[model samples]
Target: MKQLRVKVTNAVGLHARPAAVFVGEAGRFASQIRVRNATRNTPWVDAKSILSVLTLGVEPQHEIEIMADGPDDTRAAEALQQLIASDFAGKI
Candidate 1:
């Protein structure tokens, strides 16, 4: 299992578009991934699910924790961390 802590840099946070991007990326990995707001009381939610991610209420500058458990856990965690750190490439 692997875990990463990253701050969301996207201007609008993980809303619709960014959440969709994140869900797509997570789906590419053969691992179970979950996410939660690191600085809040939100419970961990399935990272690959758009609805679950959106419910997180993540906002810009919100620190989030990503956890992956499986053969590709490390890669999954790293990729997601990079994606959030880069603000989803300013796409959303």
Candidate 2:
């Protein structure tokens, strides 16, 4: 298992397009990936679920935590970190 925190850097946060990118990337991994806001009450969401990510209502600079567990967990977490750090730029 692996976990890391990242800030949403996309000008509009993880809106439709960026969330789609994220979900696509997450789907490539054999690992299970989840993302969620740091706020305690929020539930962790499937990284492949665009609707779930949108429900997060992420905003610029909002910190999110990514968690992965499986054979590809490390790669999954790293890729997700890059996605967040890039503000979902090119990947979008």
Models 1 onward score TM values of: 0.95, 0.92
lDDT (10s digit) by residue, model 1, range 2-91 = 998999877888889999999999999999999998877699999999999999999988999999999999999999999988878755
lDDT of 2 by residue, 1-92 (tens): 99999877778888889889988999999999999977544789998899998888887878889999999999999999997797675766
Best by lDDT: 1
**Candidate with the greatest TM-score versus the true structure:** 1
Model 1 segments more than 4 A misplaced = none
Clashing pairs in 1: none
Give per-candidate clash totals.
0, 0
Angstrom error of the Cα, residue 44, model 1: value is 0.6
